[model samples]
Target: MLIDLSSNENPYAPSCKVAEAAIQGLEGMNRYVEPEELHMLRKALGEYCGVGTERILPGPGTGYLLERVLCGLAVGRELVVLNPAFLSCLDLAARLCKRIVRLQLKPPSFEVDWTLPASGPALVILESPNNPTGQCLISREALKSLLKNEDCLVLIDEAGYEYAGKTFMDLIPDHPNLALCRTLDKAFGLAGLRVSWLVCGDAFMKALHMENVCLCRPALRAALAALEEQRAVLEEVKGVIEERERLKAALSQLGLEVFPSEANYLLVRSPRPDLGLLLRKRGILIADLSGQWFSGYFRISIGRPEEHQALATAVEDILRTEEGFMD
Candidate 1:
């Protein structure tokens, strides 16, 4: 069996409490999710986010919320995005927006420039701790500067906030043009449930009518249980973070270029351009970003220590056989 680490998923399984809740929820599958159950979820999420229930909007996932918001607000407006952002968001912008302005983040330091040009009626979308690169690209002061333009609406995707230990949710009350998109798929070990939500500001509340949005019964139950069992989730997250550091050091020791990551994965540049293929033959699966975005670059999700050992071994073998390949 192959150890798949293409997607940035938590290597741990959901807590027992979450599993039991999902089983219990299966009993009510015949009936639609009751409004009260949805309310309970929103209320739980609001409390977890330290915001009021009115500001929270639950959905199937962050992708769904982003699509709805983009369809409603991005039409006929300039959509600004980072080049190596989430692919789905980039595709959505290409289809839904009038024009796109891609801010290309250079290597070594994938920093972002918040000083956007004065364009009328624009929508700016950014992912902090951006995908693929696994680096946080925004600052509090830079974000605040972007929000000063009343004509520009800023949407920040904090999908990896749990691992990064940073968030801008507190600014929602003050900035009418700001919104945040988050998901439980990463740190909470609930990817299969597709549980996600949006924290909307006053302007977003009026634009996206999210009152009727609902998650499936099982997903709803699992999400509630996960939120309730916060201690176990935090412990698992701590474990993953530690393993990430160890893996980064291991890969760096092998003469591979490992970039610093604030997310649950690492972006690496290998000497061999076909590193992804070489690993696949060894029954290991990792994301090769070369075809998708850059050459000789790959993204490796944090996995079990044993799995990392297997990968390191395979890489070592490749290095020995391909000596002087880069010359």
Candidate 2:
């Protein structure tokens, strides 16, 4: 079997309730999803997020909701994003915003300055535990202070929130300009369901014209079930966390520059840039990030212990066989 560690998908299967609910949802496939059913989802999402139903808006996924928010609300505003942010975020900003300001992340540390220069209405997207790099943009306290400025709208993409355990959701109560986007696709192992929610404050929610957009019946049911059994989801996350530590230690022992990550994946800089191709030849797939900001670096999602061990062995073999391969 091929070991695929490119995408940061949960290495474990979903909760049992998700499958049962999905099966139940299939029986109602003949009808279009009802509005009341979606409202129910909103309620569940609100309860889970510790926000009100009005503050929560569910859509196909975070990408869809993000596009909608930018298209509808960010027309006249400028877009400020960190370098090496999500590709989708970049595409949306370019298509929708009039002006784009990219803040270059500091090298080695790969951290961005949270403070913004004097600017007009702008939509700032912050990806915590950023993809590929796996570094968080800012801390909770810095996020709160950034929200207080009221000069721009802050969209915090907390897709990796479960791994980092740092959030600015509580600051939403006081900051009307702040909106947080979360998804079940990451930690909850529900990527195929396309279930995500955008949480906004009262004033921000009032400004936008959110529709009755909802996920499919099966996805909604499964999302609700997943939320109900969230404890089990956390348990699975705990296993991933443990595996991540083990994998990091193992990779570091191999003398590779493994970057610090608070997410499900690790960013590793190999002495051999051809390591990705070598691993792929052995039926192991990883994220080759050479074209991206991290040259000579690849991203590997923390998989099961066996998968990690296999990767370690493959790396060792490739380095041993190849000439001039530095540690």
Candidate 3:
């Protein structure tokens, strides 16, 4: 099916209530949007986040939220991030009125360095359960240490938190300098809607020009529906998580070095690069992480049960037949 694990998303749709609510919301299509729906979304989201609704800032997605965050912050200097980072961080930082520092992650762990710029204001960002290789976390102690050394803003992207089983949202209300951002696309299955939000301190939120509903009428409806019945959405998420664990084990059994992941993807290293290319010829698509290092590696997404089975069977067959990480 040409599964697109390249982007972290649940193939499932939002709750059944989401379809119903979307249909119901369409009935009021001719009229201007009531700020009330957005207010309701923020309320439900706040409850979900375990924070005040006023603390949550909703947007199109992480892209929009990050853009606004960089634009809104007048932190007199630049942005420093872990290189091989989610590319957008560097892309957005480029447009900002600041210097950009790209630090490569320390090998094996891929953790960022704590020695940040000690000058004026800085925006230091990191991702937990980060993209591409899906390298899980940087430890709570590391997070605390990073925050302690830099007086600047620390943004943590929690896009994959649902699969990772952790979040800093609960910490945002208490930690004035921390901002925790999340997107509905991964867990909620609302990728088409591009709905996302972040919980920051009241001071950080109040400074920006806030709007009740920033997305279009269609996306707002989807966001509300998804939030209203998050339990069902989470059920699908659990399935993805379970499948990921199974896939990880299968890869390990084959003697391939599979980088441990808390998210719904696996980074498997082969003795040679040809197996990755071979999988692509067989119509299987996964990222080639080989170029990043001198060694051979590829990342595969954990799809639905059948999709995962196909991947497992393919790997097993490859080993049983044309083994040797063939070209």
lDDT of 1 by residue, 1-327 (tens): 999889998888898889999889999688999989999999999998999898888999888888888977888788888876664666877888878888876787877767885377889988877887888888888889889888889988888889888899999999989999888898998998999999998888888886877689889999999999877777888888999999999999997899999899999999888889889999999999866467788999999999999999998888777555455
- Residue 227 local lDDT, model 3: 75
Clashing pairs in 1: 129-136
Whichever of 1 and 2 has more TM-score, that candidate is 1
Pick the lDDT winner. Answer: 1
Candidate 1 at 201: error in angstroms? 1.2
lDDT of 1: 0.87
Taking every candidate in turn, the Cα RMSD to the unseen true structure, in Å, is 1.6, 2.0, 2.8
Number of clashes in every candidate structure? 1, 0, 0
Over 42-154, each residue of candidate 3 has an lDDT whose tens digit, in order, gives 88778888888888888888888888788787346568766556556456577674688766654466655566754667777677787656765566766667666435777
What lDDT would each prediction earn against the true structure? 0.87, 0.82, 0.72
Evaluation by lDDT, superior candidate among 2 and 3: 2
Q: Please say which candidate is ahead in TM-score: 1 or 3.
A: 1
User: TM-score of the candidate numbered 3?
Assistant: 0.87
Instruction: Score candidate 3 by lDDT.
Output: 0.72
Q: Which segments of candidate 1 are over 4 A away from where they belong?
A: 323-327
lDDT of 2 by residue, 9-97 (tens): 88776867788898788886989998888899999988988888888889888888888788767777888877655646567777778
